[model samples]
Target chain A: MAKSVVEIKNLSKIFQRDSFSVAALESIDLDVKEGEFLCLMGPSGSGKTTLLNIIAGIDRPTGGELHVLGEDIATLSEDALATWRNVHVGFVFQTFNLIPVLTAYENVELPLLLTKLSAAERKEHVLMALKLVGLADRIDHYPRQLSGGQEQRVAIARAIVTDPTLVVADEPTGDLDAYSADEVLDILSRLNRDFKKTILMVTHDPRAAHHATVVRHLEKGQLLPVEN
Target chain B: MWRLVLKNLLRNKRRSFLTGTSVAVSLFLLSSLAMVYTALGKPLENADSIPIMMVRRATGIVFPMPASYGARIREVPGVAACASLSWFGGYWKDPANMFANLAVDPENVFKVQFASTIPPDQLEAFQRERTAAVAGRRLAEKFGWKVGDKITLLGSLWGFNPELTLRGIFSGGPDDQLWFHWEYLNEAIGRMNVVGLYWIRLEKPEMASRVGEAIDAMFRNTPNETKTESLSAFMLNFIAMLGNVRGIILLIGSAVTFAILLIVANTMAMSVRERISEAAIMRSLGFRPAHILRLFVGESLLLTLAGALLGIGGAKLLYDSLRLTQIGQFAFADLRLRPETLALCFGIALSVALLAATWPAYRAARTNIAVALRHTG
Candidate 1:
């Protein structure tokens, strides 16, 4: 009986384009317990990413209650939601979106900058995060100077540096080669298992989904239970 | 976060340099304009140090008042110094070599005006010689004359050859004119006396209006009545004759500042536009829209500050090397480009940069994350 980190009740999302209304999500009801590694698998336009965004508080559900860490997503201001997300949830994207200007340590050190941590404390935490991603040796390298796999590891370092309760990854390894993809999945698996971090990952690759403890399918705009 | 801002600048070298240049050029124009404005108006601001002219009440530029009033005006109260000066108009030794020449009282010349950098020995020598002249530094350099050399003026006003020895040459303050002895000239044509104008100096600045009134009132009912004015008023009267140069100068400053604002704004806008995808990525990394806004604004402010530093530095260098004698009467010697002025230019550049960044920042902040992801994908 673990505490639920995310709870969604009758959630739906609608997007308007020029002159047409498109439904991105419809009646998505779900509960995700703390420390559970859940995967949402679907094809393009299947609303998998949309559901992750809603649960992560990056997007609104248009109609219904989405409670992340006990706070309703709709009621939070944009600034409040951003601050909440920084402290409570971490995100990893398909593109290893490291700031090209900053070094590995600095990029990993960014989210901590928003906090009131002392410079020495920030450095210590940043070093530990990079070490966790096995990139402590390349702390001073710029994102452009790092390999694709190394850059993705730095992105991972940045994500976990804040020690957030929930981690949301959308197509996290979609841009990497097999070796890099495997390394990234292994790190994410370790984050969920060893660190006991709750992970909600959206992926189209079956092999990538296999690392998750539980897998859920999304078709068009509805969530379906995984078949045995 | 600031580290990221710094890295972004270095990563895109061409864009950063372009933005920096836009800010630098605007600052350069502003600095130069301020220097010129300060140079031109300096004498007017220090009017207490300079003297005024006494003109005939009804006489205009073409007419002349009797020379007898020069001696009579010397007797007025608060008039610590007085001298009569005939325009002597411009001297042309050759038709091509023309410059200012004035017939002035040798005895009272040193007594009046900001004496500038002339020694007492030279002034005494010039006065005792009777046929001597004290040439301005600029006029002496133009004719290549030494202290004892004789200069012959082919006078346009009196239409005579007034040969006089250059007893010494003295540098005058910003508003100096060349002078030769009036006694020497008037003696050459005795009883044919006529003083072009009388120059009077008051001992205290506050006494100027009172003395000016007394001088005019003393001869108010006289046959050769007079009109007297402060030197600043005379200079302003001359400046007024130019009809809208001051207004035009102000208009030009405004226009230049406006053009600079546009240049800065355009640079910031382009910088923001190119970083849309990057901004989207930042948001996905849990950076709020306000964070994105500050990054863009901070970058612009930094660019403008760099430009302002360069522009102000260049201006100070230019002002230092400049020989103002060749650039008309720049009434102040120290036409400096101040640090505060640089800060102000930086401030203006920064404001323009920030203003220019505002719209793009809004666009970046309110960006539809889903659409941005879709577009990038």
Candidate 2:
């Protein structure tokens, strides 16, 4: 049996604007195990992104018990949560949010700068991560210099450069073409299988869900039955 | 970190260059004017230390007094020495090419001022030779004068073109002037003892006002009544004649400094606003708020420092090449920028940079990662 890396019980999130209130997430319950590729699928406004953000430690639930890697992130302070995220969670976004000022190599080295790793060790880890994404040759290229697919590859390299315990991806392929989408999905799947990294991905595409080991659905921020 | 800042600047090279150039120009103007002000004001600061005071006609600086007033001023209590001075408005070659030309009692002018300045041998030679004159090193360099060279002064105060020999070149302690025997002018003008002003050296500097009152009391209600004041006071009179521009210097410096601050601050704010998504991504990557603050402020300071260096360097180049233009009374005659001016310029640059970075750094540091990520593309 795989060990549980993330545990959520009865999580709820409500946002208030002016005189109106909207529920972004409501009473979500789920569990993710080590090295599991769990894909969350749902309709457009089904709270998939909100749930993923909560699990990534970027946003906290209003009421719930949320734990990742044995640490209750809900109990952590903002700075502590940020530190935990640095060491434990990697993130991939739809638009490939790599700093445009930095080259592919420097962008990938961002997370490592927080650690005490020597320059040689950091360079070695970054090179290996880029190699895993099959972008070893594009290390010197900037985001504007690369294609949509190459930019996504560099972003994935940056995400995994810290060897995070979990990778949380939110609509990681929504903006890419069919071929570029497959390239990113291949990298996420490989990160799960070959590197044994736990992945919690939010996707609307059935083809992307096919690559996950276990698939789940969210309706109004509540998790449905999981299918293996 | 510096590389990151450099790369970010290069991202919008034109905008950075334009804003940086403005900072450079502001700093150049501010620093140059400050240098000039300090140079021009130093002599006034030292005026009280010198015991010598000039007793002029009570009417104003332009009015003349009798040469016999020198003897009466010397007899006054606390008066150590006195000498009569006559303005010798001489111009060489072109009438517009003016320099300091004066006629003094060669045997007595040294007893009051320029006493220890000239060599004893040169003073004796000046007293013995009526045609002999002395020039400053700067004047000599400007006109290429040797000790024995004879120069003729055309037109004016004495109403004669007096031909004189160069006797001695004195370092008037950061100043240069031409002085000759009063007898030479007397011989040309046919007036044996008429003069314009008298320089009175006090036994003690603290007795300036008291001694001044006594001298004016002796000559009061009579013709050729005198007004006595220190050298610094006279310099002030000279400055007033040229239209006191200290207020303008301060006003323009403050305006320019404020302008540069706004410009750099606006550029920084715009840059940060455009990088909202990037900052959010960094926050999501687990960079602390303090980290964000450092990056933003550090980038601004680096930008300002670059601009400041260019400005100061340009000013230095301008000063290095400046010569032959003299506008100051005494202190700022050369008008070169000093080390203190450079230090103050950099201080202002650093402080303004830090001040300009504050709001933008705070905004970037307090950015909400979730909201920013949701909104920005």
Candidate 3:
């Protein structure tokens, strides 16, 4: 209905580790509309992670074009790609990798440091993001003081604090218990539905995939349209 | 940002304190040793306190001058007085108390030089009495000498057993020395034909060179050649005998500074490695790689400054309360830390910290967020 926020054409990635070659992706063409909740489902090592990384501009594709948020990331240099990722893509990792040295508020305020925002403004944004994730009270707590689910919430808060266009989550709930996983999924769903943020998630869990408006399956690096 | 750096330092208080202490100790040794070396080598602050002995017109080792030259030297231009001296090497009645003891004309020795520790009345009284000598306070204290005591010295240069009365104990002035009269010394040697050197004092110090030349020309055909130097230059020559101790100390100082640098660098590398995941997380949250690098490097500078302050404080305390006065008349001139040295140490430490940060900061800056997250996860 709206213009696509992420446009990809003939995207492919090859993994070459110590002279062993593996085709991680093959001519993958996809369009993600603005505010869409898209799920990429596949078994482990099926190019789901690679595709997500490429979209996030964290990795460059071996061959093909990827235009995420109107920027052809494949043509950008490493520095430009890093800058682009900072402004356009936010990542949620499976392990909820928060900096152990920093408090939850500092962790969430990290992204704002790159901006020219005043310290007061950065604090306001960080508090709002934490409140959105329902962890405003835990702002001063260290990562070790938080639960697995709470840490993931802080990670998500860090991701959305900058209000980027695309949120790329790579099995964000994989390390949590079922209840915690559901709780994290609920927050992610609310982000998509209420904030109207575009999300591209990689997950093998069917129930986790259920929140996406569109779910695509990848097998052997090839994307297959869902029959349902 | 400064708050963050400070907080991190305070957070790891034990580790920070230990590392800071190591740096402080090394720098303390460096600064204190430098002060000691300077005190030993530099000219005494007061110049008028000691008598000067100058020989004329021969550069190498001082061969024996004819005993007749001593009388002629007494008549040279600007010469207030003169006395012949023989370098008598003294061994204490106990071997461990051995120190420098030279044989001089005892009558003129007191007139030409002042021994601060010796009571004036007693020094005059010792000069009038034969075989009587004033012992330096430090030397006397070392061997436990009393005014009326008798000490035995084994003399190597003149080859004799010299028994002397310790008439009074004397302390140090600008030129710290220990001496006894040549009369008591030469008479005991059973020879009246040899006087090894001449000690001269001038009313006007600047006329010493002309006076030396006039004296040397007076004995042109004599077999014993002479070498003359000002008091300051003679002491400088003595300093040369220690064989580049100053240079060696400086080299050690630089080496210690570099060692501290390496330690700081290693710490930074380990810290950066441990924080790889945090770096990635920050990058993902739209924080630039440069920001992380700054944070890490800033933390290093903070640690180094703390160590430097501790080191400088310790050095100041030690230098101010130096107890080296026990080493005889040699007083350290202005034994306080120079602002320049403190500034130099600070500059060196800061540079070392910055140098140490380069690798870690570059690694953090170049790390790929995607790859970093994957590995960390």
Candidate 4:
């Protein structure tokens, strides 16, 4: 009975390369409800990340109505979209794209810098986020000083620090070993279950999909039926 | 934001330091050239207040004029005082200790060249004692000469070597010369009754051109024709002998400025290009394009401003240290780095920062976030 946090109807995305046009996504109909951990599983170049980007307001769709949180994202300007993303959505990339120059604490505080939060409030939020990921002790450590799994945890902390409505991750465990992969997946699962954070993740590993509440497959830019 | 800028600069310490050093050296050279140019014009800055004129042979300064011309020059309607000034090129001990030693008419030199402040008793002693010489304060300090010290000058221009007593030390107005009695040099040179030039002081600054014309006309078409000009024009002719110093400084300054611009532009371009992915990440975190641009520009400003401070400060320190040295005392006696010059250098630094960072920052800001992220991956 949860309200739908994302709604997409007949969405299409086409990329133009010189004189040729390639359809990245065609007539994609998808709905993600609040508190749902939706896993998108597909092969390479199957429009998984393309759809995720569009839903996150990072890229624009070629046609059809696309709405997230009941707002038509396509109608928003670039700056407005960026502001909306800052307030409403969080992102975790596969490569752990934390600014190398910033420390773990500062990296997590990046999004809060855009908000009107005071220094004390930002400190509280950053420390709490780092604590959630069990990285409070490494708060002052630079990104290069941390291990691969730890760096990914820091990225996750940065994503959730702002307490966004939705967290979208693109192959967050693609570069991790088995143990670190499970650790990242466990954290994502905990965020979805305990914090009731809505997560939309793209993955290729079947094991990652096992942690999802609802799983869907895509083939050649078209969505398949949801797996029970 | 500033914290981020600092960290980014520290991220590549070697490159940042090298770029900053280049800026520092370029600005140092540029400011030094400007200081020298300004120093060359220092005498002319107060020339109008003094209202003095120099009358020399029409041919050249090396050609002597009649010392009797001083009496004729003094008779001019607006002339307040006239003195014969003969260059006595001599060295104190070694050729390396060479300075401007002049044989000036003791009775009227102070009246015409009143900028030099000499005590009354010393001025009287200088006029009474035929072999008395007065050294400038800086010249005395350089050679450690005191009052009553007998100094011997080994003349380079004339065959006679003159021994004289230092009667007084004057404090102001090109205080780098030693002045002895012109009558002494006249007698030593077999009573030639010839002088190198005449220094004429006008009763008022407005009478400079009229008095100069009258003086020149008085000696025109005679065996010794005279050319009279204001002190500033005379200094300009003297500087002209140095062979286009202003043009050379401008050329070198322009080349240095352009080179630093290219160096800084290259550095900024490389720095931004290396961080395209990081810029995209920041944009994804809700940093606007303008914010990104400000960040890069702030870094460049910080870098260039630091360099400007170093260069300007270094120039001041270096020149201030040279103020008492032989070269500084003789040539750049009043050399100073003016606040206007410092402000101008700062403006140049700011302009260099903005120009260098704009294109690279713009490219990075306008880069597609998705494409940048993918490309980095």
What is the CA-based DockQ of model 3? 0.43
A10-64: candidate 4 lDDT, tens digit per residue: 9999999999999999999999999999999999999999999999988899999
Looking at model 3 chain B, report the run of 10 residues with the lowest lDDT sum.
Answer: B325-334
- Top candidate on DockQ is 4
lDDT of 2 by residue, A1-228 (tens): 999998988889988888998888888888899999999999988989888898998887888888889999988987898888889889999889889889899999998888899999999999999999999999899899998889988988889999999999888889899999999999999899889999999999999998899899988767887555
Ranking by lDDT: 4, 2, 1, 3
Clashes of 4: 0
**TM-score-best of 1 and 4:** 4
Model 4 RMSD in angstroms: 2.9
lDDT measured at residue A220 in model 4 versus the true structure, 0 to 100: 94
Model 4 Cα interface RMS deviation (Å)? 0.8
Return the top candidate by lDDT. 4
Q: For model 1, which pairs clash?
A: none
What are the runs in model 3 whose C-alpha is more than 4 Å off?
A74-83, A225-228, B6-18, B29-172, B191-223, B229-233, B239-266, B287-289, B308-312, B325-348, B355-357
Tens digits of per-residue lDDT, candidate 1, B1-377, equal: 67677766666788778767766776788877766555445435566655554444444534567777877778888788787777776564786666567788788766665555677888888888867878778767766777988778784656567887888778765324567878777877664677777777777767778888888888787666777887766555545556756576667767877886677678777777777777876676667898999898887777777887787677777766775535344243345655555566666667777787788878877786655665442
Q: What is the DockQ of each candidate?
A: 0.56, 0.64, 0.43, 0.68
**Candidate 4 structure quality by residue, lDDT tens digits, B77-151:** 999999899999999989899888999999998888778999999999988999999998878988999999999
**Retained native contacts per candidate, as fractions?**
0.43, 0.62, 0.60, 0.62
Q: Which pairs of residues have clashing backbones in candidate 3? A: B58-B226, B104-B182, B117-B170, B117-B171, B118-B170
Q: Which stretches of candidate 4 lie over 4 Å from their true place?
A: A1-3, A225-228, B41-45, B56-64, B119-121, B148-150, B158-160, B186-194, B206-230, B324-331
- Please give the lDDT score at residue A96 for candidate 4: 97
The CAPRI quality class of candidate 3 comes to acceptable
Worst 10 residues of 4 chain B by lDDT: B324-333
- Considering just the first chain, candidate 3 attains a TM-score of 0.98
